[model samples]
Target chain A: MPENEFEKKLKKMMDDFHLPPSTSVWENVSRRLHEKRRRKIPFFFLLAAGLITAGYFTYHVSEKYKQNSTAAISYTGKNADKAGNYLLKDSAKLSTQKPGIKKEEKASVSNTLPGTQQKIFKNELNNKLITVKNSTALKDNSSELENDNAGNNKQHLNGQIINENNNAIVSNNETLFKNSITIKQPVTPADAENTLLKDEVQDNNLALKKDSISGLANQPGNSLKKSTTKTPVTINKTSNWQWGVTGLYAKSNLIENLTNLNIPSAQYSNDPLTSGNYDTAFKTTHAFSPSAAYAFGTVVKKKIFKNGYLSSGLNFIHLSVKADIGKTVDSVIVIPSPAYTYFVRGYAQPGFVKTNTSKYNFIELPVLFQQNFFHSKKTSLSYNAGFSVRQLISSSSLIYNQINNIYFSKEELLRKTQFQVAAGLSFEMNTGKNNSFFIGPQFTYSLSNLIKNPGNSSFHFINYGLQAGFLLHKK
Target chain B: MDYKNLVRNCLKGNAEAQKYLYNHFAASMFGVCYRYTKSVTDAEDVLQEGFIKVFNNLHRYRHEGELQAWMRRIMVNTALTYLKQNKHYSSELSYEEINLHPVSSENPVITLQAKELADLIRQLPTGCQTIFNLHAVEGYTHVEIGEMLGIHEGTSRSQYARARSIMVGWIEKRNENIKQRRYAGK
Candidate 1:
């Protein structure tokens, strides 16, 4: 068999051959392209709807957390304050009465007469015995009292009555002194009897005077002590358990600076296939506009020390960023390849105006330690430092290539999770009882790349925000 | 429309220009696909798929070569991909089978139309038909066909020879039938 005749004939036959295709082929291709375009429209609409729904849910949850926390704090504060004030007043009154009793006992012992000291001593000793017995009975009755107001003041009054018994001994010494001077003429039994009768009457008068003094002390002690004790309890309980809801708004920006790989200008221009002057410098300009961000969460703060607290909570955050990237290529080359014999092709050097808008949604867990530097009844200043672990729930990036007139969308390009460090300073003004309105300036710096691709231009997001919240302190 | 204008409009997503481009090139490209596939319906499927790829990748055409040739390359590549995916051609070949010759027969060359010749070529085994079409009609060397089909160059040569012998036998048998019909008419 010879190749010459067959090859020549077949070449001639195929060179002029043409076979018509069915019309339905173009219809199917057109329909598929239309379907592709239609597919993208609903995806964008669904994304927008999801974002709105999440935002609505976050708002209601934040509001509900704030109301519940505020009510719980106020209730706890009032109850604990009432209990603390009652204890403080009782302790103060007992402390003040102990000294008064000692002074009266010393006075009674020193003022006794020497001549009738023996007989006067017997009456004074009997009066001291009776006073001690009466004081013990009063103490027992006072301890048995159960009324909130009455029980608190009765213990103080009983202490005062015991002091008055010491005063009774002093009154007996005075009666003896007067009797000895007036009845100096005789040492008779009748004189002694008259003195005893007069002493008994004096003792009765002293008991009535002591009772009036105790009544006077009880009235003022209850009124004056109640007012003084309440102020300190409120101030001391400021660092107790607290909860709050912060609505956050932030201005976010990316730190993007890409290192360009420089190739020699002469190398590109001297190639025979290249037809243009080449620029050695390869520079990319990244224009970043301020991106809006929002976050809200319920935070629980437990007082761990006098001025320090530990806080943790679940926070939902939405961060959006827009970046315009511009790059110019120096030269374009055409390499004629025998493998792809139809076209002379090389690397495409189309200058692109790539505008990228990225939105990220995350549920974050923030663990923070806060310390109050300055605290007062009306205002407080505090600073907190913390780290947060954020799980990415959803993300989307829309990239527009102006040179190609193409729009591409990518979802979940970022990593599934990210970490960040945050620090803030808060200025809180006491707005009502156990409640404060706080405004804080907070800063967050990302610790890891938010995206999965390492070759993608590195983006470090620095977020600065004003955090406004209602803080409720527990007792 | 001119080639450059047609391509530029297609790049701009002009539906009319795309349909014009498809109408202009579908017949010639289908000729290329028809030679590679087993039937006209299979060829039509390949033609539709190839044009879709061409439209999608029009931006990469560069316009440095003839538009027909670029489209021809895409169609060829698409046909090869279809054959590989469908396993119409066996990838494995035995050395003993390549050496085996067709039994010789006494037949004369018969003048046949191109369509009849293509039908005779399609009658050969799938591997031989592909090698023969690539080497003879498409003007590719044994080395290029081997690279495309992932076989050795010697194997492509052997397969092309066998396809040529089979087609010659079919043409001889057709010519003998024509002689008998003439004798019966007498």
Candidate 2:
């Protein structure tokens, strides 16, 4: 049957038909075409703003906590000063009134008196109330305090009768001294730590008070009790900046999404017709494998919040992707032109058993936000998430061209800069007061395509790595 | 400047060259989009998407074909993709396999204006309308249309036949109205 004349007329008329589009069509199209380049600017600005806001919030919270801590220290110091001055006044009165007290009674009094109190009394009363002799008097006092348990509640300090209300004079008995000082029995195994384990105090009188407690703890009968709440204080040095060097080893994988780039299937495969269609180039017939990758660089980290930190650094990353290309053989192709014949030397592909490797190296700057969820005095565990802006330093590979049927440098197709998303958790061990060592597993994936003009094909690399680093704090 | 030079400048990210290229081909491309889509707004959407693809894939053009022809194919593909994915058109484009009787081959002279003809075509059921445009207007064979639209070749042929008969009925009715109006003027 002949084609319908109606269809012929319709085609002719439609071919000539033209309707002017609304002006907004161009506006939309133009905006979309240019938006790719402009999109990054706003994203980076938003990220920076977010970081700044988070840092500011963390700083204020940490400062408020520090202020509250300082207030606690001052409150504890004031009470210690009051106790010290009161003891000094009572010792003076005891020395004048207790002139006829026997040596036996004086020795008993020294057994219950704390060392700081005894030292103060000796100074104020001209060595009449209590005296410090290296081993002889102190040793006898320790044994006497233990055997005199029956008389623990009542004690005579320089023959002054002290009442239970704690107003008359300082006690020479273990029970009265414990009630007056509020110093619990030594809870630490170490004799030194028993006194130092108390919350940190800067006042001189408080230091002397703790020292006197240590003297009591050293007595022969005193038993060291186990301290169940042994908290090792971890100072968040949020204001201090730290610098570090990091190194990573990873397994890298390449992801390819073909869009418009022509794939020379004929060069890699024996079939020439396969090179014409877009799908043939992207088909899973070609195998791409990953090898070892490494990254190394210096980083600077600063604490932003009580548990948050913002860190950025420069790193050099070396990545390798291997493609299976059967057995490789040398081949020369002769090109015929009007006036010249060009000879191009390259590799010949047979099957998919052999492999070839390609190297892509990048210099990257990363901005990472880390928050520590767990902290001990000597160790901390934190998770970090952020992005990196990377510049392609070099690429080494021969790319196949469908149009020319020849090999070209892949550098021509690769973009200069790309972006990546990175996330990881780190376990940090504080080696010294101002230094730490950290190690963790990290994963980084590319956000931008590797190809400069990824017409139909998008290429990216994903890396799974173990990162280790050392940080030195700068005070 | 010539199209080759214009394309080269566009590749260099020259805004003026891109605008020039869009201005040169946008009207014809919009006409193509309008035929495939349901409304003027939908046509413009496809036109916008199509032009972006054209510019992004401009490097692959290879200068082997007319730039206008290359862009038109992109627009056509973009329209078909829009029809399948767009909620407004996806139900309309869903084709059911039904037997269609052959339409009359006797020519009914169609003297309607091009815009009038396009409007009538738009009024056809979207499934048949697309198959009609693909096979009748775009010159794709029934087999190619089946492959492009992911349907059986027989279904495409039947849908096109149904689309043609509906179009003829609309054209004939409009001709009768014109005739009556002319007689009243006399």
Candidate 3:
């Protein structure tokens, strides 16, 4: 290059010296873009197909849940006498927000009518109020208790116990209520009269008498009227959710065995794992996968259907497979092996066997039937049997090196996609609307081998896993 | 000048094209960030965060005449966030008490090698390096740099001119050193 021209060009380059990021970064990104589009080729169609299948599943599992439930509704003989009125109600009221302690005190008092529990709560409240008004020393303690009450109610499990102020009341009655309830002898008449008088004095300005509300079945015309504090009795709703989570272990073959005994390669290389040995040259193993699932969709629920949750979402899957690329070992013989023999070790043929490590990541979709027990109520035990499709997202491949740092010859390794059927049992959690977490165990059978193996199929290698997870949905 | 098209392309999710726009102007823009920050890593962080802001708010880019100026504003703001985060983590280091080294002038251009020029530019003690890049490469006025960096205008000018004069002096001394070695070889 000429000096002047070089200088001019150098100047231009100096004037425009911008460093761009490497092309490989973009190549990897664009490659992903193309792969994404390629995968999407069947995405909409599969989604539609899934929607229809899920719709059918959504329909029939619901029908099945109904069929199973109606048949099983009376499944539990806990009460053949009480029959359908089984009240396993999981309900709580927002009690602490009742504006005043008086209402709360009254409710407890009414429920006490002739009952020892009510008298105990009433005496506790009066002593607490008198203690609050009387002592300057106790004033500090009472206010402190009140402050502590509000904080704990907010932390209570059910919405009903949100009474922070109740803690102060409990603290005041701490010594009185802490004793055991079951007694060796009933209270004497004098003791009972004293308890009644204390209850009467405290009822000085209150409107309703405690006796009328007690023994609800015995309450006459005025009993038809409900007290403001008397909460509506809760009976568990028939629409219950099913959920569960599980962990799995699976072992499969990298290749399917060639069925024909007379085929050229079938008898040509006489290895018993190929012929009769259960241990094929290649082995696939999957370990420790946990998943949780829940079923929802109410038409089936209303009918007391067995299965109704049609679900789709992401699964963080870690799958590893080890491919042993050598002649079959002796112990795994499952084929008719008159022609082949197996070796525990040492090569029958002289070549380094190629071994490839496979790791897989996936997203799973399951459409299943969710069922309830004999009766549909607040909580139900449920199980699901469904077709599951897992899409591979990311995979890691391990390449082994020889002394020369050369890769083992692989005329193998790559194989077919999977079509699987999964059966699982889940414990459902329906806190509100469409929110839930399902925990359970699932078993999967791949109709199509991820890697094919043979000899009249040495027996099926299926995946056994546990699943636990949560999902978001429209209300 | 090209702000409208750049914002449009970025909003359309053209990543390669967006990266192109960043590369096209990041160094010159980085000089803007460096003027405020005390270190290269901080400046680079500010630059990255600034671009993230630019990308996220591309839709709000309403036909501004100077895209670089708009980006400069964001970079300045990002640098301020760095300062705030730094201040929150550690009480601001009181540079107020320490005196700055007085700058001297000695032109040292002729002795520079290609690799040495890049390296030396990289080494100008972050504060002066940035002022130098802004004045020499990015064509910013000292007043603009000062306003954006929150330094006095005269300080910006002095830092810029001092950065150049120091580079010239270093280059000259290097040339002399090379000459002495050559003579010794002979």
- Give the number of the best model, judged by lDDT: 2
Q: What order do candidates take by TM-score, descending?
A: 2, 1, 3
Writing each residue's lDDT as its tens digit, candidate 2 over A383-470 gives 9998887777788864433334433343545655677889999999989867999999998888787655423234677889899999
TM-score for each predicted model, relative to the true structure: 0.38, 0.42, 0.33
Model 2 lDDT, residue A410, Cα: 30
Q: Write the per-residue lDDT of candidate 1 for residues A383-470, one digit (tens) a residue.
A: 9997776767887753322222222343423555566789999898989767889899998877666533343334556689998888
True contacts kept of each: 0.57, 0.74, 0.01
TM-scores for chain A over all candidates: 0.42, 0.48, 0.34
* DockQ, every prediction: 0.22, 0.27, 0.02
Q: Candidate 1 chain A vs. true chain A: TM-score? A: 0.42
Deviation from native of the Cα of residue B51 in model 3, angstroms: 9.4
- lDDT string, candidate 3, A1-475, tens digits: 1123322332333345433333333343343334444455554555568668766755665555333222111112222222221111000111122233345443432232212222111110111111111111232343443443343333221133222233223222111122112111112222222333332323321111122123221322111222233222221123333333323344322222224211111111134235223343422222111222222222112222323344443334455545334342222111222322211111121122444454555555555555533222223456767665555565553222221111122112222234457777767565544455556666665555342222122212245555555533331
In model 3 chain A, the worst 10-residue window by lDDT is A85-94
Backbone steric clashes in candidate 1, count: 0
Q: Which 10 consecutive residues of model 2 chain A have the lowest summed lDDT? A: A121-130
